[model samples]
Target: MADVQTGTRRAAGPRDTVWREPAGIGQTRRARPEVVRVASKAIRKSAAIVLLLALWEVLPRLEVFDPVFVPPLSENLAAWYDLLLSGQLLEHFQASLTRSLAGFGLAIVLAIPLGLLIGWYTPVADLLMPLLELFRNTSAVALLPVFILVLGLGETSKITFVLYACSWPILLNTVSGVKTVEPLLIKSARSMGLGPIRLFQKVILPAAVPTIFTGVRLAGAYSILVLLFAEMVGAKAGLGYLIQDSQSSFRITDMYAGIITISVLGLLFNLLLLTVERRFSTWRT
Candidate 1:
């Protein structure tokens, strides 16, 4: 009987360990509670933040870095407070916001239609994409000198430069969005006998909404980035100019404060875009 059993076991291919082991499949199977999973993730994230703060505190306290070169959080806040009290900080903040919004608006106006055109027609894409890529590759800073010469060191020049830099993202995203609409969707619309305009209205635009929004978000980021340089070059007011001036005068606190303000503003703008994206992309889910 033992020999027969051994032979029968040998005839069978390898037994599944998971099925054979007494405590294997059931006990080894994952059964993490939702609470534990959430708690673990939260713990990891909190630990990461705490680690960063600890490093920030320790690095400056040790003076391993030059105090002048690296202003600690406290010193930077003090400088920010001083600027806040003087009202200079607010003035610059407003100027930067104004320029960024203006430039971003211009980019939206120009990029959306162009993107749609390119996405809809292969010929348009073939002709224009090369030129777009060429211009996009060229540094915005390289064009700054020409803009300054043509538009002067005024609000116009600064905002327009921002628009020029920010437009590429919006345009590219829009084109991609339109081009990437599901072929089935287009075919379905055609089978329904939808006209060109109706098809674009019903299928293309809705599908492209997410992509268009992506472009807008990217443009928003570039708006601030380009505005920073614009403000730095020759602006009497703006956060970029404020930072430049502060650094020039060795007011490290003010410089740090300006940077903080810039970061906060940029974050807010990004949040605004994200909110819009979520609201519009609800259908995707």
Candidate 2:
């Protein structure tokens, strides 16, 4: 009987001592909260968007506002769809995008380097500060006539206006970012015998990146706003022109469609910048 009992008993093994989870249990434990978090955030954003759309759709129908002024959301959507199908929307969008992007790109290329130079050197900042302050304080729109006159009614004028509008925010933010780097960090880097260029590249630039990004985001928003105004003032094919034309023609729905398109485009541009900023800015995390 003892021999038979001993034979039935299992031998002690590594598997017996080790705690083993079922497949996927660990992953589920780790991923579940993240999934829930993302889903909840998405649900909240979607709910807000849906509620706004519902209000937009219902308000005009209720006759509280003039239907002519605030066309039903559905009508605007239908107009947008029609425009899209006819390719008119695409043409205007492409034209606007080209001009806006061209101006924004030029602004970035010019502003960042000049910002760095001004921020790094006291003499340069002193020399440029008064003129910069004057220009920055002046309204971008106020300079529109000057640009149109100098650059003429060509694409160059429109792009130049956008560049001027975008430059101030980027330049200001970059200077602020560079100036705000911790003095202790600079001292520590100097103590380590890091050269000025090396210290700037390794320590200063990294520290300044977040603030610079803030300026870049501001510039991006400014670029779109200025571009729209420039387009509206004088353009044959752009969303601004579309809106102007529709308004003149009393095509309320078409005008709303243009407005909606620009709103969406602005939102998309901000989202794109945010994504890029987050990708490059892991240090903030």
Candidate 3:
């Protein structure tokens, strides 16, 4: 009887041990693979950039490239640091940021509604599409002289040029997004007794958000590109001006620093837009 009781107690102890094991241990084991996968993906994605930067640092030191014409990455970083300390970088960056935000904001305000109207109304599309096609083909940089002639070389011309350059992408994308919404979705909404305004608000707008964001991202890039040209042409202060002045004066390291700064700024801006895009596109997930 004692042996039987001891056997039963031993069996119970094993069962209790199994039951007492933490559920979190299993979850942690499962979660580790996912975390590792994400980390590996990130590393793979960053490999090319890392290689390029490594080459930039190495080739310059090896004298494979003339350091005068193409400075080492370290030299550029030093120059960038010096500029930062002197407050010059901040001043130029502020100037560029203000112009970019102004033109980008104005383009968003002007394009989205206009695009919706043109896309939704047949008559409006018929009247405006041809003109848009014509102007869209014309390069914004080519019209620099015309802008200077009219708006002059001040901030007005630069801002307006940015506006013109940024507007097309946003406008065209908005129009496309609105027009390309699924017909079935529209029909279903209508069948449910949804009014035109409610239909647009709920169905069409949400569906078009991804496409519209694509254009906004493009316009954000263009705002910087067009602004650079505008600044290089006449401006006394800006990243563009900094690069131009540095080059003209043969301060090669400084020029590269400015270029790096512009690249960093664009990268940061793109990341910001991507975050905003993701926020608006959570429904797709």
- Top of the candidates by TM-score: 3
Clashing pairs in 2: none
Error of 3 at 50 (Å): 2.0
lDDT scores of the candidates, listed in order? 0.85, 0.88, 0.88
Candidate 3 off by > 4 Å: 1-29
Query: Order of all candidates by lDDT, from best down to worst?
Result: 3, 2, 1
- Give lDDT for model 1: 0.85
Cα lDDT, model 1, residue 65 = 67
* Full ranking by TM-score: 3, 2, 1
178-233: candidate 2 lDDT, tens digit per residue: 99999999999999999999999998899989888888888898888889998889
Instruction: Give lDDT: candidate 1, residue 157.
Output: 92
> When superposed on Cα atoms, how far off is each prediction in RMSD?
10.6, 11.7, 11.5
Model 2 ranges with Cα > 4 A deviation: 1-38
How well does candidate 2 score on lDDT at residue 135? Answer: 91
User: What is the alpha-carbon RMSD of candidate 1 to the true structure?
Assistant: 10.6
